[model samples]
Structure formats: structure tokens, C-alpha cells
Target: MPDPALLSIKDLHISVGSRPVIEGVSLDIAPGEMLGLVGESGCGKSVTALSIMRLLAEPPMHIDSGSIAFGGANVLDLDGPALEALRGDQIAMIFQEPMTSLNPVFTVGDQIAEVVTLHRAISREVAMARALELLGRVGIPTPDTALTRYPHQMSGGQRQRVMIAMALACDPQLLVADEPTTALDVTVQAQILDLLDDLRRETGMAVLLITHDLGVVSQYCDRVAVMYGGRIVEQAAASDLFAHPRHRYTEALLRTIPASNAPGTELPAIPGTVPPPGQRPSGCTFHPRCHAVVDACPRTMPELTGEPSSDSLLESRRMSLLELNHLSTTYPGAKGAVVQAVSDVSLDIAAGEVLGVVGESGCGKSTLGRTLLRLVEPSGGQILFDGKDLTALDRHQMKAVRRDLQVIFQDPFGSLNPRHSVGYIIGEPLIVHGVGDQASRDARVDELLALVGLPPDAGRRYPHEFSGGQRQRIAIARALALDPKLLVADEAVSALDVSIQSQIINLIAQLQKRLNLSILFISHDLSVIRHVSDRIAVMYLGRIVEIGPTETIMNKPQHPYTQALLSAIPRPGVARQKRVVLQGELPDPTKPPKGCAFHTRCPMVMDICHSVRPVLEHPTGSPTTGQVACHLYQDQA
Candidate 1:
């Protein structure tokens, strides 16, 4: 009645040393179906995918029990030659980090051609031709030039496309993509996802997609299996799981995302963290974090069953906290040129509100955030905070203003000092500001760590000892040390895994409520921006193109750029919509276009857009009190 599974794993038990990682995990991927494996970091999503390919190192990592069946054979029992024959022929894998996965010495084309030659009895020239064809198919521009380029010569997205081309070299029966789009920008992510979907349709290849992004799982995968602490917590059709999650863990995860709730309201976060290997709680691994915990939850594992009667809106009211009037920040470039990193950017963030700024890299969102904190001194315009022009404040005067304005940078590791202990990192703010003595600062550091969901003793450790997510928590603790009224969180959660990303997002929301701190949240992620922001601002090369209520900007985007971004978001379980892929990269800031900077890439570009710059104004019949900078709305005014 149904197509047989292209790949199947039954009763899989994996262990690294004496500690078990994946216990009795089972999964299936039918031909032409996309299966998403989701979980937090260290939850065996990647390990399981590796196990399917027998890629796990033998001594430390061992597969004690399980059968990975593919193409009517048990992959576990295959001999060296047989396994080698199977790999890259019938089954191929695209790893999360292409930089590390691809060899550094070889050209991308040489590597891809090698795979083609190895699998098929083809000449080097034939293989090279096939490699070029694969590159073009995966949307890489100028495949001929790319053929000679090494992995380091390419951008992250380009490298990933090369990885995909190599994976599809043999047109394998099954494709295993592990967190393929995690590090990519949303536009590139959309392109990669689209490429995968297209390849799947054309070749009828099954995809085993593993990722922590629930948004991706919701939109891309046909079926979903949610993993928790190395075990399958829940499995169902993607739509069914989203509509009605049976497990508490699944429900908590779905409810915790910012987009799932109302703007400004605190997100429901899953308490505590996943336990270390072999030290799982006696019965349920998730019992510690489960909000719907029963008394027996700690002693007995609840069978995955549907008994869910529950659920969840976020609308944030406005109260002006900070305002910018024609704010501009610029830097001198080569030969008398000026790079307008941020130009005439005017917006406001309400008290205890998240005003999200979204744009591609180099669109000036990060510069705008820095300008708000006076980290980048505004060359022009006024930055009004509590009715005072921050630009006019002297160094001594600005030092006091700095107490109310703090920032959290994108790279947590880079932002934090390597030589400093966690305690010192968090307490330094208090020390520098003359707020407390050494003993009092230590106590305050502990308190701040607890507030951000880190253990009190985490203060004793160094930054390198902690994971990326933990390091970000430490950064937040430091940001909160000054009791700042406004936080410039520039791409704060962008570097984290999806599950950890949710934790940080929720933590920010929680802190925003606890301290009533206004946030200038800047990121390229539209889904995350829509979830947390009270109002949304879309920026293009050095200028604000649109600003509106979150609902209006996300649901009914008026600006063409905003519309393109929203459409690019990969929603799970839905057929890929016809997206407006903005052609070409971001324009050079030093030499921008004559009028609207976005006109070059805009699909609905008009003659007027090329000659006259648009201003932020209420679009005709706009449902909300939002503004757009577009010629399309010019007549509406």
C-alpha cells in the first residue's frame, strides 16, 4: 500500500565509552519522504545520523545493538569493501560544517569529481564535467570558476552548496543532511532547502534531515521525530505533531518558541538542562524540565500517548523608551570614500519592548544597534534617550548614560575575555562602576548567574570551559550587571543551535520582563524576529526601509524586501512557496545606488525607484500604524 522505507534503523543502541548516548532509537525514511530528526545539542541527533552511515569511530564509540537497513541489506553487518561500495553510491551524507568536512588541500571541483569518478567508472574529464553540472544545479554561480576554487575561497553558503553537489554526485538513494542550514543566512538557507527539495523531487531520493530548528522541521520535513537525551520522545507526521504534541517535552518545545506566543509576553521556557551522559535521571530524562510534571514523572517514564488538552497570544503595548531622529553613523574608506554603515536610521523602542531589526549582512542593522549605545559615535542626527540628546553628551556625561545602555555582541567568545573567570567577567561591570566591594561583587555575580539560568558555581569556571550557549548566558549576566534600561542585542542568539537558541531567546524575554528592559534586537532571522518583537524594522543598505507592528510586518508585509524575507522562511510540512529570491548580494555601502538602495534587487522595481528615494510613511490601507519606505506606497500618502 505504501512505498517501502529507503532507510530504517531498529533498536539502535550507541555508546561512547561506558556511557550510552542513543538508546533503543528507531527511525524510518520512506522513498521521496523527508524525515527530520530534532533535539538539543548532545542529544544524539548527529550521532544517530552518523551511526546510519557507520561513521562512528570504533573504540570509543560502539554500536552495541541495532540494525541499520538500507537497500534490502543491514548496513551494520557489511564488510569493509561492501560498506565502502555502499557509501557515496547508494547513501551519502552532508555534514553540518562543510569547512571541516571538505578537505583543505583539494579544489572543490577536484573533490566532487573524485566522488563522481569513484562511484561511477568515469574518466577524470567526465567526472569534472559532472561536477560542474552539479554545482550549477545547486545554484552556485559560475561553476567553471568555482571548479578551481578551494573550500576556503568560498562563503559559508557556497561551501555548503559544494558539499551538496558532492553528496548528490552519485544520485544516492538516500541523502543524510545533518544541520545543513544551521550556520547559513536565512536567504542562503532558503536556497539550500529549496535545492534539497528540488533534488529530492527530481531524483526521488529520500532525505534524512537532522536539525534543532523546529521552524525548519515544520516547513521542510514530511515526518518528524523529536529526540530527547538520546531517546525518541515523540514521532508523528509533521503537521500532526505541530497541531497536537502528546509529550510534555514536545509541547514545551513548541510553546517555547517566540513566534508561537504573543509579542512582549514572556516565553514559557523548559526548566533545567539536559543531563550528562550515563547520569540521566532515574526514569524520565525530561522530568526535571517538564512543566506538566506529575509526581510519578520522576520515577516512571511516561509512554508517548495523546492526552493533551492545552495550549496558548503575544501583543505588546507601546511605551516610548528610546528614540532616534535621523541617526547616522559613517566610516571613512579608501581614497576619500565614506562607508555609510548606518544612515538616517530613525526608529523607537518602547520600554520593556523588543524592537527587532532584520536585514542581510552589511545592511547596517548591527551598526544601528552600536550607534544607539554610542559605541559608534553618530556622525549626524540626534539619539534621544529619556528626552536627552546622547550625541551631545561629553565623555563624562556619556559614562553615566552608559549605565542605562548596554550591549551583547554576536560572538560570545569574542565578546568575553579569555583571561577572566566567569565571576570576574560578570562582576567587572559593578567594579568599574563603583557599585560594590569585591565581596559584594562576587555575591552579585552569583545572583546574576542564577537569574540567567546558570548554576551558581558556574562563576568559578572560565569561558573556554563552557559551551557556546553557556557562554552567551554569561554575556547576558554581564549585560544585566549594570541594570541597563535598554539592551543592544546584536545577533545574540544567531550563533546558537536551535534548542539552545530557544533557551537564549526565552531567557532574553524573561529578563526583559523581570527588569522591564527595552531591547534593540538585531538579527537576520525573520521567524525569531516575528516571535519576540513588539514592532519590526526592515533595513536595506544603511537605511530603514520599513517599520511596523510585528503582526503587520510579518503577516502582511508591505515592503518588497520584508515580503521577500518572510517568504524565504522555511516552514515545515508546507510545499515550498514561490519565493522572491533577491538577486545579487548586498550593494557596496561606500558607493550606493542613486536613489533607493534596494531598487537594484527589488522584483517590482519602477523608474521612480531609480530616481527618488522613499521615506517611511503609512502605506495605503495598512491595517496597523506602521511605515514603509517604498515608491509603491507613495501615492497612498
Candidate 2:
């Protein structure tokens, strides 16, 4: 059943410096449910969140015309005192980046206590006690000691928890969480997600979650609203939207995420960048970059409909391109401790595909890719490439296959040496494989640079001389130099901005088709995985709990843990309610849970989950449903 509206906005028109930043936007947030707002960066997502709190500053910006209703009262029309009363006492918010939101100089405890006392009229002693309890409720260990610690002293995850505790301290009916987990590690992100889910069940508060990630929308939000140029272009129930996104923009978003089934399908990005506010085109804002764009799309806007065509209705589905069999990697930790990153995980990748692996920091997505290339010795497992056993090859023997395999790492600048120019970096690979000498290598480097959308002369520039995006281009050139069939990318674009990230993703896509190079793109970004991979694998501490086609895993994630991790991505450009942001911290890898790695934080945890760990198994009814290890899929109730 549809939830009743808790907050509503109509004719929302906002601007910065006489420019229309948000235009004619309207949305609804229902009671005890989350509405996900999503789009790319600068799509007015943050601005919309600010407008809800009546927090837009003057001069450069203002809400020209809009009716923002909270508890049936027009919040935009409220006076300062009335608004302040509503903020903590009625509606609370958790902004993006808690480090910036928190006062660094003050103790975390005092900050939270201040909110409680100011809103509740409680004594300082009572407020402090309440603050400590809230802290504890948010799952912060040593809540009392944590209170005295400053914002800087705490990790990014802790600060977020503190922010949540403070927001909830007022017992507000609405919670607005804006990209709360964008910068967190996988494990920390998992803990935060679990906590948020718990809080939502307990408080019955409405949640408005804003983010750019579709996976989060699929898992956490009951309904999703996709934003483009400050307007909702698409919205529907989470399952319906993910299963059958109407707008071309929404479909493109789903395609961008990496998957586990198809190991190296090139990620398809929406063509072109999201235009800046000032430069927005007329009619349908997404028409400019949409491949399925029609002549009418440029002159007429598409409305947010309740229905859209499902993916299965499409004429054809993407085929697979790569595969991994019995792949395993064990890393040695302190004092004889062995951390099995990818333990005997076997999966296949068909022609022209991407298999996206997702999990917390230590979940082994990156490790699996490395072990495939023998970068890390697989203690046990078979890595078959085109029916040939990779495990049998020595470094020298593997060198023959190295020309068909490549790797792109995160932090491109760190990967390239400062002393050598971009030309040298890309050329080194060609020279190593005896393909070309100095002059030929130089020519090849220039061609590669041009292929990656950089100028020919860019080859002469030093690593430090270019921006993050440009350096990454150089890194790609280096990876492609060997002209390998497979490319392994380890957190390749996580540190980049949205605009730059899209550009890099597009470049990779173009290059992949042109060269037929299979890629192992690794990252913590679920949206990227969805857009890129044909299939997705959700990893926990080390094992992959869920593996399925992109549509299945994303639209109806069988595993509870997969659902939570998907709920963590930040959707940009939409205005919706926040969710149980997420809960708790990642469990310790050295001291993992006894049975299911995720059982410690699982929402639908069972008794057997704590004693007998489940293996990566396929559903009996549908053998091709892909592999999911969770007991949820086991019973299929």
C-alpha cells in the first residue's frame, strides 16, 4: 500500500544569482517510508535539501516561489522562530559530510546536548544524559568517552552516527539524510546502514534519502524519484522503477553499475555530462545526452509516470564477456592470521559483459581481480581465461597473456611517476612487450592519449601538471598500451568528481568496444557497478553473498545484506525523504561473526544463520537466477 504524505512541496522554484537552479519541482514524502531523490552532481539535489530546512542564504540565492509543507503547514511561509521550532522539535536533518556539519572545536557530546536542551527545554544534566543515550542508541561504543571527543578525533563513520543521533535526539517526525555515506569505507558503510534501518523501524519517522546511486534506491527506498535539471523525470515504487525504468535517464543509470555475473561488460554511461544549471536546454532536460532521444524529446518534457517498460521487454539483453573459476586469495595479516579475501569463488562472464563485484572495504572485489592476474598468489583456485588455466602459468608464461590483460588502479596520480611524462608512462607497456622502441613507443603513446580524449601534446606533460581526470587518462593509456583482452581496474575512479567520473567511464566504454578489451573494473560505487556490469556480486568481509544479473540483483536483491549495501549510495538531482540512513560499523575481519559474515547485522537474521554458514548457491526453481548465498533466497517463501 502507498504511504500517506508526510511532507509536500509544490511549484518549487529556486535560484542562485538570478538563475533558475530548481524549476517547478514538486514531490511528496510519506509517513514511515523513504522517498529516494537521485541524479548526477549539481542537479539541485543539495539545493532542494537546503530549501526543505528553510536554510537557503540570501543575495545570491532565494526561493522565488514554492510551498513547502511539513505536517500540513507550509514551512516556506513560516517565520524564523516557527521554523526553528520545527527543525529539531518536528523535523531533523543529517547533511552530507558530517565532518563539515560538525563543529570541530567543540566536543561531540556538547554539540548533541545543545540540540536536545534548546529544543526540549530540558536541564543541561538531562540533555547531556539524553545525548549520551542517543549516542549509544546510534551504536557508538564507549558513548560517554565519545562525547568528549571532537569531530576531528572521530572517523567519518562515527561523525555520521553522531550527526544521526543529534538529529534524532529531537524526536522529529521527518529525517533528511543527504549523501551521508558517500565517503565512507565499505565496512563502516555497512554498519551505518544497519543502524539506519533499525532506527526507521523504531521511530516510524518519514525518511527523505538523496543520492546518485540507484542501488540504494532499489534497496532502502520504497519509492524512487529520478531528477534531471531540477525536475523529477521519473518515479515509481522501488521494485517497479528498478525493474522497469521508463525514462531513458533511469535505464542508463541502471546500466552504469558494475555487476558480478558478466565480469567485464563495458559500463554504459549516459552520453555527455549533466549540463550546468545556467546552460540547461529547453524541454526534456535529458534529451541532449540520451541515446534513445527523439525529436520531440528536445521540445517536450516527459512526465513522471507510474508505469514504464520492464527490461525483459527490451528486444535484446547484453551478453557476457569474461569468467572466473575457483578463484581464491588469502592475505597474511598480523601473527599467522590469514584473511581469505575471495574464497573459492567461481563465476562465469560471457561475451561483451561486465561482472561487478561490490562489498565493504575488505570484501575482496579488488583482491579477486588481482588474483586473476596473479598479482597476488591465489592460495588455491582455478582462473580460466578462454578455457586456458591461468593458474598453471608462471610469471614468464603469463607474460604472453599479459598483452591481453591490463589493470587500472585508483589514485591515477599516485600510479604515474612524476619524473616521467605521460608519454613515458603509456609507452613503457608497449616497450616492455617488445612491441615498439623509443620512437614507436612515443607515437603509440600519442595515439593512446588521443584515444582517451586527451590532446596529442598531453603526452609531454608531467603527472603533477594535469588535473585528477587527466592523470587518470594517462593511467588508462598505460593500461591499454599492452593491448590486452582484459583490464583490471582497482577503485579506478572513486576519488574523482562526478563530471570527471562520467568522462572517465565514457572513455573506458569507447575504448573497450574499439579494442574488444575485457575489463575488471573494481570500485565501491554501486551506481557505477549497475551502470557498467551485466551482473553484480555483493561481497561481505571477504565472500560474495549475492551474484546475479544486474536487473535481478538490483531490482529485487534476494540477500538482506545486498539490499542494505545497495541502500548506501547517494542519489543526486532529486528531492525525496531521507531513510534509516544505515546502521552500525563493519564487523572486525580478524574476529568475524561465527557463521554468516553478515548475520551479525542482518535484519532478517535466523538461528541457522548463526551456526551454519551458507555457501554461494543458486535457486533451485530458477537455476539461472544466478548465485545468492543468503538464506532469504534459500527458502523462497
Candidate 3:
């Protein structure tokens, strides 16, 4: 016989101000089991998770009907004291954003110790000791020093680890983690997930992981539940669910993952966004956007059913549109130390080709992008654009060249002016370049907006008036206003929900083809980079470790850093493979490693790697094999 469920939620119906947010949701998590609850944003995944812990605000959020049972006890019926005891002691939660969830005023030690002291009758010294132990367990380096550091002083990954440590202080019977890895890099994300899995096995605690990332679910969870329109549409074992999904919604979501699709191919994005809480359609909330919608889908709701469910580079031999010849960008750090943001990078983007620059945070990918456009002045090396040296151009000359080189930033709202209308924002480039009159610019704005799949009248609204995805579209329109030959898309779609990300990615691919524009796409997501890039460049500590055709790099990465990155990517519908988790955090940019920049964390590091720097070259002495910078590859050539 199997063990009783550690956490059981039945017939949960939650409403916010008379509007149903979660309707008829039921889930079960057995002891030591990890259950993934997945759906697009606003699909009630978080609401359901919050309801399980009784964390929802009272006035706006009320449980219409439901029961959450933990160890056969009704959580909904608990009084104030009982609820307080239940929380942190028996049930702990790790919220999505650690920065906000963690108390900013306290040190890491104080915050974690408070959880221990509150749950257990322990002295401050013992609580502090426990906090240090938890920190070490969660993979935080130098736990003693980390305890005294403020939340703002640590990296995003470290902050998340602290959050995890605090949650596990009491060794709760169940842990509710909501999008814990959403903002983390793939390497850090893998480490955090692995830590959780390890701790679960050791402590025998169940986990309810709520995320939109199907890839994470496929690898970590024992079972999966699919939510849509505030209801559970499908639930099954992870393997069974991925292999043969019974629900149409589940099938659609699997198709939308960039890793599951071919390189440079258009993603089959679900049409329209998720309907708001009070504005869901009559029957199926997904019916309007569902590709496999039937006549019955719009009029009749479907029951929850058991289901088993399941880049080629640009080939055109065009001339180089942009060329970086031994490019380097350096910034002066504190105490007159020089930070090597971009070091000795050399690459060329063929006309209309998409070159992806991928690495973990602080790897100099973003700095490389900024340097290419002269937004940050380079310390050395030449930037040749269309046979003209950009470094040689004066301010006036660069201003004219700016019309041919434009950029799309990651945060749409931050890049856009709140006070300006979308039309003005899009047409500002034309005004700056003195390309057309007001009437002509307005016409151009409408054309640009239409090109990005936005309605013509959308220009009348401000940035705040539009959704996140829509705001990104406005940013794209603005970038296209000048019809640049090259576009630097710096983490373009990383901020969006998965469905919306697909839509934007498809739109970018479409526009790239239509305009025959070269793109320098920079991101930390290897999966996404593979989907949109013709060629991939892996950066490590301000240098390119490898550059190759997307298919070649994805299949046979040569550099240790590149291999580790590819190995860390979570593949949906597939079992987790052995990952090469790098042992240490990124080295300080101001004082990089003596020889190979990645040697400090390289698993295959040798004595030579510790003393001699490797140059980027064809690993197998064949141009077609691509360039790799590593001591191991040097001998292979």
C-alpha cells in the first residue's frame, strides 16, 4: 500500500472581489513527492498554491468552497495559533521574488534565525548556528560571511538559496515553491533544483512546485497537473503526461517550447493572450486561442481527465554587415582597477544572419552588444559596419550611422517613456533623423505597428495602458522605425510568459525575414538562443569560449563552459541527463583567472589550463567544425 497524501486539496474555489480566480481545483502530493502545477500566467496556479497555505488576503480573496488537508488535518479550519504553528513548522513556502519576500532591513543570518527561533523554542545562538548550517546545505559559499551580508549584497541565485534555507529551517513536511527558478540562470537553476531534490530525499518532505516551465516539471516532478482558466485540465505522472497528453491545452503548451522546435522555424504560437479574471470566455477560457478547438469547446466545459501526453543558420552567402575585430571594452572599477567587460572578441554577422551571444550573468554578452553599437565606447579594437570603421567615425558621423544600427532592450516598460504616446515613441527615430514630416512619420508609425502585429490604433495609448507583451511590441515598432540593417535584441523575450514569449519570438523571426535584418541576440537562455540564432557564441568571463553553427554547437559543444551550459538546459518530455554543474561562482571581472578565464570552475582543468591561455581556433583543424577556446581542444586540432 502507498503512503497517505502529505498534502491534499479538494474542490478548491477561490474568488477575488466576486471574481473567480481558482475554480474546482484538486491536487494531491504524497510524502516525499514533488508535484508540479503548471499553466500560463493568470491561470490560477499561484492562487491555488497560496490557498493551500492559507496565504491569500482576506478581503479581496475568499475561499468559496474547498478543503486543504495536511496530514489529515483541515488547514482551513485552523485558528490563529494553530495556523501560526502549522506555517513554517509543518508547511513552508518560498515565494517567487526573493528580494521582496526577504526582509531588506535584516541581515541574512537574522532573517533565517528568526524562522528557526519562531518555530522552535531555541536560543538566538542555536538559531544562528542552524541558519549557518542551512545556508551551507543550500550551497551558499562561505556561509559564515554570507550570514552577515545583506540581501542587496548577494546575487539573485544566492538570495534564492537563502530563501530556500529559511524555508527548510524547520524541516517542514511540505514545501511550496512558486517560480523559484524563474529569474535564475540555467546553471544556477540546475543547482537549486538539484539541491531541492537532494534535500527532499534526505528529509522526506513533499514539494508543490508551481511554475510555467514545463521543462523543469518534466525533469524534477514525479507527477504533473495542468491548469488552464482557473481549473485543472489534466493531471498524470510526468512521463505519461509528456508522452501522450489527453488534454488539447497540454498538447498546445508542449508545442510552444522553443527547445522542442527546429532552429529558425516559426513557433506555432497560441493566438491571443490569457483572458483576465473577470473576462474569461463563456465555456473554455482557452477556446478562443485554442488551435484544436471544437464546436463543443466554446459552449461546454471539459472535465479533468487522465492523459498521457507528449536552428539551421542563415545559408545565404551574403557579405558581412557587421564585423568585430579583436574588440575590447574596459570599465574603471573602484580603486582604479580595470574591469574587462569584453575582451578580444572577434566575430562577423552576415547580412540577415542572426548571431546569438549566450552566457551566464556578468559574462560580458550584454556589454558586447552595447559596445557594438558604440553606446559604450570601446577601449580597443575596431568595429567595421558595412565596410566603414565605426570606431573611426566622429559623433556627427556616428549619428548618421545610428540610423542603420538600432537596439531593442529587454525591459519594454523601462525603455519606453510613460508620458509619450506609442505613436510618438515609434516615430521619434524618424524625427531625430529628420527623415519625414509629421504626416509622413505618423503613416510610418502605423506601418511599423502593423509590422509588429499590433493594431493601428494601439499607438494612441501610453506604455502603461498595454500588457507586457504589447509593450514589447511597441518597443519593436520603435526599433524598426529607422529600418536598421542590424538589430541588437538584448534579452528581448526573457521577461514574458512562455506563450507570450513564443508570440514575440515568432514576430521577431517574421520581421527578420521580411526586412532581411541581421540580429545580435543576447540572452542567458541557451534553449531560446538555439531557437532564434543562425550561429551561437558562448561567452565566459568576458571572452568567447566557442562560436559555431547552432546545430553543431547544440549537438557537439567543444568548450567546457559551452558543454556545461548545454548540459544544464532542462528538456521537456525527456528524462534529466547528467549535468556538469560548475563548482564555483563566476570570478571577479576586475581580476579574472590567471590563465583560462573558466579554469577556476572547469571540470576538466589541467595544469596547462592553469598557466596558459587558449586562443579561439578550429578545434579539429577544420573550418567547418567551428572555433573553440580551450586547452583540451588545442591538442585535438
RMSD of each: 23.5, 22.8, 24.3
lDDT of 3 by residue, 479-583 (tens): 988778899999999999999999999999877755557899999999999989989999998999999889999998889898999999998999998999999
* Candidate 2: worst-modelled 10 consecutive residues by lDDT: 307-316
**CA lDDT, candidate 2, residue 201:** 77
Better of 1 and 2 by TM-score: 1
1 against 2, candidate with superior lDDT:
1
lDDT of 1: 0.85
Runs with alpha carbons beyond 4 Å of true place in candidate 2: 1-322, 573-583, 620-624, 635-637
Cα deviation of 593, candidate 2, in Å: 2.7
Q: Go through the candidates in order and give each one's C-alpha lDDT.
A: 0.85, 0.77, 0.87
User: Highest lDDT: which candidate?
Assistant: 3
- Relative to the true structure, candidate 1 reaches a TM of 0.51
Error of 2 at 119 (Å): 97
lDDT (Cα, tens digit) per residue for candidate 2, span 1-637: 3444678887799988878999888777766777788999978888888899888887689889989888778998788899888887788889888988999889999999999888887799999999999999999989999989999998889999999999999888988889878898878877876677778878888788888877666778877777888887766668756765656777778888775126777677677888887899987888888776544456656444221222211212222234566677877878988777777687765433456778778777888888888888888878777546888988798888877678888899888999997788889877778885678677777778877888988887889989999989889988977656578878888999989999998888766554445566687888998887767878887777888888898887778777777777667776644532335667766677887878777878888889778878886566567788876666633
Estimate, for each residue in 546-606, the C-alpha lDDT of model 1 and write its tens digit.
9988888888888899999998999999999999888999888998998788999999999
